[model samples]
Target chain A: MANSSDKQNRLQRLWTWFWSPAAVLSVGFTLIAGFLAGILFWGGFHWSLEMTNTEEFCVSCHTMETNLGEYRETVHYNNHSGVRAICSDCHVPKEWQHKVQAKIVAVKDVYHEAIGSISTPEKYEERRLKMAAAVWKKMKASDSRECRNCHEFEYMDFTIQERRAAAEHQRAIDTGMTCIDCHQGIAHSLPTGYQEEYQKISEALGVPKLGEEMTFSEAKSDEIRTYLDQ
Target chain B: MLQILGMIGANMLSLPGILGLAFGMMTRKWGFAALGGALIGLLEALLFAKFDFSQIDAIEMVISILIGIIACLVGCAIRRKGVLI
Candidate 1:
């Protein structure tokens, strides 16, 4: 009983000191140690982050196997010059701050995987449009930052490019149109029904190319109605 | 586990607070439990919501923090009132 009492007292004393004002030095040392440990931890973590930027790591997730297969067919993956771009080159930012932000946003992808949101190719297809839209939106917002990392207008040898390609590039420069504006399918297959979706959006927003509404003649309208009914 | 915590923070309105309170009551350390809950809630919110102060809904965060504190106090009261469990 005496030994038990002594042990309890020692434990109580240690607890008191742990919570006491006198433990400021102890707290300071702990904080310093923790900070040092954090540096080591986050350093290793950042290294792992960069390693995951590889094509191999990116495709390790079966969710991306289809994308990887598609990517392999792209010029970015292989060409006469033999220079190649990996998954991170296009999908992740080059700069650290932006990369971290992208990764934070990407945590949702991890969460989706955890929740089995796209556990199969069919499931991925079901959400492909939404996913494509999200990537498009991000690229538009960033002015295709990732694409600019490699294909820059300043360095492009337009003279060597085909006339149409040169004209389009010049036009894009003149109009401030970014790479993703027209080049979304450069890496992956365009989601199914993309044209229909784009047309609906344009119609909803009253695209300027479309003139004022034209009314059909009663006979034409009746014919169209009959066609629709059929 | 961080993912789970993040999901919990994202999906539940008051579950984090309740969890903290329950932990506090069980451990008989309501204040520390509440603080821990607040930290977890805040971290989870930032991680899962992908929200910084510049992007977050301040009202929602305040509500989460308040929930933690209130639940902890309730837990403390329960402990003090002799329901030791």
Candidate 2:
């Protein structure tokens, strides 16, 4: 009889413990589990923004492959100074206002890609030149906003450079020299392939050929000035 | 098989939380501590999901790992101190 009574007491104690505050708290842990699951979902969405750094993302379209290939061969990629700027860094504007404008302009590129308008290499070159001219005009009007981000004019003595440049500019103006006649390779390094292309195009356009091999040297460059004067 | 492994690796973010819960259950500590760790792990995973592999390189990954390890160590130390108290 006493053994049966002790067993009943033990059962009652166990039942009470099951309904205790500790048991309720343990059940509440389920809500925490749900909250943790929510965080994992949030992190996954953030990963997509990182793809801009990858070469694949930059050259997913075949249209970019030529320029990207050229860029890879340039001093920017070769010197390993680790300061490499991709197409967007130079072409796109820095400020939010300009960024939105650039994005809006990019719609045309998407449309062109969709329509397969850029078929041959020649057509690609024409399209690229057109786009480059548009970008150059925008940058020039804005005093090269993207360039100024890295190369600040304030650091250089513009007064002395400007004076010298003005004298050269006036001489060029007097001699009817085109801007490219003097400052052909200001933004990018001059490639031999581009020089050959320039010669071909000049011949096709009925322009007089620059006889001597063109280089960055002052003596070689003075010949270009004299040629422009003629 | 490689693809399956990649998928499994990608989905392994929940492992830390599961391990934390298991540890709590084994030690008879506040079960909520384990739940909290799991919640933190989930939050970390969610935050990580927002960043694409291009944006978050190896450096960012290392920083995040360091953060997780430090948080876990701090939590464990506090728990140990609480037991002593």
Candidate 3:
């Protein structure tokens, strides 16, 4: 009981010191100054984060040329709605915790860039499968959280969707399948043997192989066009 | 593990509330406290909202502001009682 009382007294003293207004400068002035400094620091940090999230910053590296070209050809870059998903929108997590982790993990990309790991198109192609697998593995593990930031399953209007898409989406919901489970090459070109790589990644990540046999055949492509035409 | 860490990081956003409490304690003024809290809360909400007003958690924002106000009021009461440690 004496030890507990001593601990409480110590805490009380600490609290008193913390809130004391006995500094050389007026406590009010100090508090306001510190508060403004905090704002500036936070603003600068946020600005830096936003600056790095831009498409120009992402494609600044010549190694990203291939991805930029592929992404430009996708509907995400050029659609009737004129909506655009920049590199960060698809690659970065919107959640604060995940975003910080992603930013930290992304520092490795700079190291690779400095070393010219995939500086040329040929070198990029050689490592494309492995790189794609890594991203797929992350997406699988996170259940494609970044994708859901823009494409929420709960908000999807199945009535306006193509028959195949509607059917597949319903099936996915029923089976606990995620967006990345079937939409591997939506924004970028799939590397050769991506199917095998994806399979291995899913297995390694312990994600259920829900769409193991699913493939977008030519008939489904025709159906998609028909649905779009309507 | 990541989620837990993320939550702690997010809670750091409330650090600004201390400024409100300090202002009230030093000035013994409720108006200054309210203004400080409101401004801080607004800035924080806008920062996180990122132009998407729909994404703002109204309840969380309000609660943060309320907590700041309460802390400031408590600080003012303590200082008014001549408890300047």
Candidate 4:
């Protein structure tokens, strides 16, 4: 009976300890565990984002296959400098928010695929010019936002470039021309008669046909000169 | 390029589901609120997908449901802690 009473006393003490102020630490422990879990979750999310940004993955879709084939033959993919520019290097923005937005825009291809918009190589060929125009528009609108990721105006040494390239690059800087305005088909296979399509777009937009030597219709006219000279 | 668009198109559905969950909780039937919110959120996200392969869309669906659950929890906590009653 004395042993039983001693056992009861021990049990009572144990319960009291369990209910003591120390129980507050459980909340702290839970919060720390939660913070750790959040870190792991973010790691996994960012990992997936990086994984999909690779060249190999970009070329996996049939839509990208043709462009990839063309890219493989290009100087950017295989050059003496050994500096390679992958699909995302020239395409995807460096900022995470813009990258996310750009990736979001890419989802339209799914709808196009669903409707068999360019299921066949022949269909892609037919739509090439329209597609090129769309890309050019975006590039122009963004002022070659992605290209600046690697090539910045401040970083360019025009003297090192070919004489003609250097002169044109300088001229471009003076006139506010973006990289895509002159560098169409730099990385991709140019569609047949893209020049005509470009011309038509140029006429519609009233901009100089990009990459052409300017035949200025209003060459620094007096009013513009006065405004600028001020 | 299209993938980014898909992400936006797919996730926009969460807005509506979140709305449904918020109002559903007012009914005070938590099981119905949670189940209905999650179901609605998942359904809307799937519908907005525009028929894509949607590798990340499942993530979107789960996020909306989680939002619904969170909203429900918040509503309950407020109801309990505050002098609303």
Judging by TM-score against the true structure, name the best candidate: 3
lDDT of 1 by residue, A54-116 (tens): 888877776888888888887888888999999899989886535655665678878887887
lDDT of 4 by residue, A1-230 (tens): 99999999999998766545543568679679978997898688778878878998787776777888887877778888999999988877775545665677766766786787887899989998898887776676566777887788789888797675676678777776667656667778778776666556555554435443432312322233243223
Per-prediction TM-score, chain B alone:
0.57, 0.40, 0.59, 0.53
What is the TM-score ranking, best to worst? Answer: 3, 4, 1, 2
Measured with C-alpha atoms, the lDDT of residue A201 in candidate 4 is 55
Better of 3 and 4 by TM-score: 3
Which order, best to worst by lDDT?
A: 3, 1, 4, 2
Range of the 10 consecutive residues with the lowest summed lDDT in candidate 2 chain B: B2-11
Give the Å shift of residue B78 in candidate 3: 23
Worst 10-residue lDDT window, candidate 3 chain A: A212-221
TM-score for each of the candidates: 0.55, 0.38, 0.64, 0.59
lDDT of 2 by residue, A47-114 (tens): 54234435677678877766677677655455547787766666666653245345555666678777
Off by over 4 Å in 1: A1-39, A196-230, B1-85
User: Compared with the true structure, what per-residue lDDT tens digits does model 3 show for residues A89-202?
Assistant: 989988763575577668779989999999988899899998888888889877898899888879999999877789878877877778877777777877888777776776
CAPRI quality level assigned to candidate 2 from its DockQ score: incorrect
Error of 2 at B26 (Å): 55
